[model samples]
Target: MNPGGLDYNYEDWTTIMNMTAKTSVLNLTQEEFIYPGNRACSGCGLSILYRIGLKALGRDCIFVVPPSCLTVMQGLFPIAATQMPVLNCTFASTAAIATGVRAAMKRLGRDTQVVAWAGDGGTSDIGIQALSGALERVEDIIYICYDNEAYMNTGVQRSGTTPQGTLTTTTPLSGKAEASKNIPAIIAAHNPAYLATCSASYPLDFHDKLLKAKEIKGLKYLHIQTPCPPGWGCEERMTVEIGRTAVETGLFDLYEIEDGQMKLSGPSQKLLGKTSLRPVREYLEMQVRFKALSDEQINVMQAEIDQKWAGYRDTF
Candidate 1:
């Protein structure tokens, strides 16, 4: 033992560190899904989300993106930022069309995965009916909502998933009145095969979730929290940093739901205990969207976080 009374060896640290590097390489496929030259904004987390997600899903999959930032960033047909086949669908019919595509693939006896990608506005507001229908039918498709918390491409309007006290075009002064919609809970009620909330800052964890969702046969939903550079009024470079803060502050915990049970995953698993989170102000102060919060508003937001964390802990 060292003088500090801790049992440690150079060989032990070396082995663990070496294994970490090797495992990271093995966990991810060495394939480039997004080619160079795309029009995505600098430090756009959605761009990162799409790049990592498609790599995990690989080329054999067919992706369907509705009228979202992704659809626009993907460019017109015949030329795209992605290397795989992507289908453009109407704003309100993403899940419905993906369901049909999966059925067709099943008939053709192809094991290719079909994924429906939508924004929070499309998934929670406009496309909820179609999404509910698809989930009820237990379609063999993956539906991912890359939630930037508002309708970014259309305008910085408030979305159903927009957190309380966040500034938006519609909620300019007073901020969003209600708390963010818990879409994962709504989907869990339908008893789908898989449900998870992943973040853009944690791509390896997100990729692992996608890989697991791919193996499942029935409905699977992944809600990924990405940062919008212009919408959130933060620096373009702060995208990943803000995302990490959101998770660490207990504002966005990662979890997986399968077999009718919900379990917190990643850093969120440790956060199952009370006092496992950093201060919420650290998360909020970074973005200009939350620069207007008063002392009372900060207290309110903290209470909300406590209640939410407690609820999840009590559930488990």
Candidate 2:
């Protein structure tokens, strides 16, 4: 923990979400799984989550990382930033590999956890089928998507997860005209044992959610909002702050869907309920990608955000 403390206070968040943390004794002998030698950009939010994930999953875990920035960042082949076994799979095969790995582990009577880590492009678009197939069978694996909204590994191109009116390589300056796909809701519809949204900015909540997912029996899905400096056109040091702003502004929400009920989790849930939510510009201005928007375009974007935020609030 930093001297200033965790960025998004978890004590306050539990109150807002109407939930409480359960006590547990963390064993000290678990081997540290992640090291600092990876190639992620400085202050990358996903890297932070990956570090904490290694802590939660422990060294007995096997990571199935598909073709994404993680693949390159993990280093070419024989070497990886992770101390545990890492299986580099095709861009759209993470979930499938995870399923296979989990089954093999069962056959071997090994208790190691299998995790499928992917990007938004790999999750919402190209890899959806593989993910769906894995989830449909209720595979005993955790599937996590560190969503940066675009295909950051491939030159910051737009993906189905990219928000409406956001700029990207494929949808540069003019902005994307289509709506971002609703991946969490889609996964929730599958009625998995767990489906949650999180951010690296909120470490305690991030930690608790991982712990909760680990306890669940069937398929678990965590959609984490990761800020990319080079991709989002922001300063490297601003990764945590930018990720915090995203949730505070309703661009992202920390919540979980279990069985069929959706529960909003995080301190910002109450803040977002205020009559006046922060303008989309406050959120957009943090990244250079939205610097080209005209006043009229911004107004249109704000209206869209208002509608989306209102809808989310209604669900709570």
User: How many residue pairs of model 1 clash at the backbone?
Assistant: 0
What are the per-residue Cα lDDT tens digits for candidate 1 across 114-152?
999999999999999999999999999999999999999
TM match of model 1 to true structure: 0.89
Displacement of the residue 93 alpha carbon in candidate 2, Å: 1.4
lDDT, each prediction: 0.84, 0.80
> Candidate 1 — which residues are off by over 4 angstroms?
1-27, 273-276, 311-316
Please give the lDDT score at residue 135 for candidate 2.
85
Worst 10 contiguous positions by lDDT, candidate 2: 22-31
| TM-score for each model | 0.89, 0.86
Number of the top candidate by lDDT? Answer: 1
